[model samples]
Target: MGRSFKIALAQIQPALGDLERNLSLHEKLCEEAIAEGADLLVFPELSLTGYFLKDLVPSVALTPESPALTPLKELSRRIAMTIGFIEEAPGHFFHNAALFLEGGEVRHLHRKVYLPTYGIFDEQRYLAEGDRVRAFETSFGRMAILLCEDMWHPSAAYIAAVDGAEFFLVPSASPGRGTPQKGIFANAKAWELINRAYAQLFTVYIIYANRIGYEDGACFWGGSEVIGPSGECLAKAEYLHDSLLLAVIDSSEIRRARTMNPMLRDEKLDLTLRELQKIQERRS
Candidate 1:
């Protein structure tokens, strides 16, 4: 028998700068996921604070030990979770972070490494960028976490895959933009292509949970989905609507995919590292 686990994607809207209300929504979604027997539940990036937080970022920032997050810690005892929030780090720095809460403890904390400052995104102005990326062990196996904008860089995914991550949990708050392509927003379609490419190239499961709602006249298209190691779209939530999607993942499938592809087994990490070192020296 292959190892398998069920996951729930909570694709809901967060109240702008309203931590109390968003915490309530998280609790509600957690209860639903538990009722459905899901082993893991994922929420979108900044799930506790809506996107477009210009100056309100500091107001909603919370540490991992904040009393406001106590309920989520309690809920983690029943089911594992990946939830995003504004993290108040040391030295008065704030980060766009996600926590893997399991068994009433913070299993892993991933601060978003890439902070987008172009277009409508101004995260760098208010949040400090994370400097690390590594996969962590979990009951389901090795997993990695990447927030919005971080997925746009292929290096992050490559590092996680090489580090033995079997699955990537992506939390995003992307706004819908550009003309419609394939009956969906261009950004959404672009994300689909990227997620599929990463899953197929790395031969790992991509569990993407994006939010849906209007903030500051921008609409977040929630096309949350789960892609298998074979680049197959297993389960997808509705676009521009609140939805809870469920998908079951099997490790045997990952093994079979890697065996057939063998890309990871053939990677030249040392050669890449040497070249990277040379480039860094030249830049210096």
Candidate 2:
């Protein structure tokens, strides 16, 4: 059963602090993606609101009760949409959450586990790390999400594989440099290697979306890719200010790659956790 399912990854240049405009842009692109025969579409991190809003985060952050999610529910009926935004809950804690929308409703929400605080990243100051990782069943296949820094961690990807996710969808908005060509192309190649390694090692498909343009003195590089279970570059978007990456996935490839290189089967989680604790103790 080598059935193909198409996915469109949106490389959007989201306007900072403008929730309405960003949501509108996403809806428009979602329509375009669906028109092109895509079964699903993925957007970058905080696309509804810019990544770094400084002190304005509290005002820009929207809860599910904010009426913003109503339109998104309508859009999901056309095509399955996965977009990242700030989730504010009862505890006054915020999470970098990705909503999985299908059939005009949000099926599930996957929060970001690995929040980066190094370099230009001040995510730890703004949000809390999420501990739950869930794999969702869809019309296409089983899928999981790894938002931004979560992709940098092998453990997150490992958990998704162990949970029986056939594919991993990543939504990221990384900084960009002055020179467009050098900055964007360089980042894309590095992410490609990283994503391909995880996909091949776990024998799962990796669908990635990276945003473009400048936000709060940081520029985002947008060169998205769709890597197959065998580490093949199935489809890729050019390193431009904004573009869309599209690909059709064959679910059977997962089993085929596993038969060749069974990395997950050989994994020992109990031993892995012990080693992690030892490494932490050494640092302490």
Candidate 3:
């Protein structure tokens, strides 16, 4: 009876380089999520500028005071929100960060720790990746945020789990990175499984919101999914379909899963660190 929260994933199709239009679309989605009684509204990675904006980064880089985000902050009064975008901070470095808004003003901003440089994702070319991982408290419980490729790495979730995060949210523009013949278990499927594996191992709610539509030659899978504490796929949106995926997270599930499995308590961190150090030694 501790707490249970309803969350909504706004799997949107954003137009590249159109700040005003994208912001308006997010505003509408936020209204819908709030109306549906969702405690958290999750948007995709680089949602403000849209994915496939490799060429638009320099031209559309925005300061925090930029007009694009003003309306989103206003929309945050009703429900808590997490929107991803390029953060033009000090120096020429732009961070792929997520903005968490509650009670209207910006509450916290979590930057993407792992930027994908390989394949079609040139995030490393445009963004300076965040270096640390820590959990942040919210109106809902202790929560953590990871963007795109960050979720694929164990550190993002492991550090947060150690830091006492009860829930984790991942914003992504992860698309179908293969031909249609491959099907089913593509990049989207791999991430879904990875998110589920992390959620089950940590006994935390994992919320993944991915984008849809084709940007240039890249095609977003749009199969945003939610994994419960027991590693169950609570809900998954249709692939390539831009829609809202909602999941009800019951915090009690965390206790129940841990009590039943007892894996969290059995973690041997010092030993794990020794093994990791040995691996590093081998690499060096």
Candidate 4:
């Protein structure tokens, strides 16, 4: 029998700069997911601190070893979890980071590599960008976590795929934009397309957890979803509401998709690296 993993997306609105309240919300959701027999639970980007923090970033920043995370870390012993927060690294530098906790410990950490500075986003001004994109081992399989704008850069997904990632957990705090038609927001539709494209192209599972509610005048649309390796939507949350979206993922689908498509199998990493090196030399 193949491995079947149950994932729960906690699509909840976080209280701005209120770590205690957000932690309570996460704990509640974790309990709910556990009751539902979920193997993993994922929260949205900056889940512990609502988006559009501006100057409030410092007030809510926390270290990985902060005692505030003890509750979630303990709960992780029962179920794996992906949580987002503002990480206060050494020297007071803050980063938009995600923590993958399992077995009562933080197994992996991913910092947001691409910080959007355009339009309503000013993340770069308050948070430092990460330097790497990595895939880490999990009980279900190797997985990669990308926070918000990191998923917009195709290279990040490609690197994770090359590093043997079978699952991609994207935690986003996307603000709703464009017109609403057919009851679907245009931004939501665009995000769905991006997720499906990456899943199909890499033959991997994509679990996107986006937050909802108003923050600094920006309305976040909750359209969190899970896409299978074959580009199928397994589960999706409702728009503009808090929802716990769950999906059971079949591990064998990745193998079947690769067997049929063979895109990742035939990729030429050496050629791409050499070409990129040449481009870098030209720019220098």
RMSD of every prediction: 0.9, 2.4, 2.0, 1.0
lDDT of candidate 2 over 48-160, digit per residue (tens): 99788767677777776569888888888989989888888779778888888999877878889998897778888888889888888877788898997898988788889
1 or 2, greater by lDDT: 1
Question: Which ten contiguous residues of candidate 1 have the minimum total lDDT?
Answer: 178-187
Q: Rate residue 135 of model 4 by lDDT.
A: 98
> Given candidate 3, what's the lDDT at residue 217?
73
Model 1, residue 194: distance off in Å is: 0.6
Between candidates 2 and 4, the one scoring higher on TM-score is: 4
User: Can you give the TM-score per candidate against the true fold?
Assistant: 0.98, 0.91, 0.92, 0.98
lDDT tens digits, residue span 1-284, model 4: 34998999999999999999999999999999999999999999999999888899999999999999999999999999999999999999899999999999999989899999997789989989899999999999999998878888999999999999999999999998877877677777889999999999999999999999998678999999999998999998999999999999999999999999899999999999999999999999
Off by over 4 Å in 4: 181-183
Q: Give lDDT: candidate 1, residue 7.
A: 97
C-alpha lDDT values of all predictions: 0.94, 0.84, 0.83, 0.94
What residue pairs are clashing in model 3?
none
lDDT: the better of candidates 1 and 3: 1
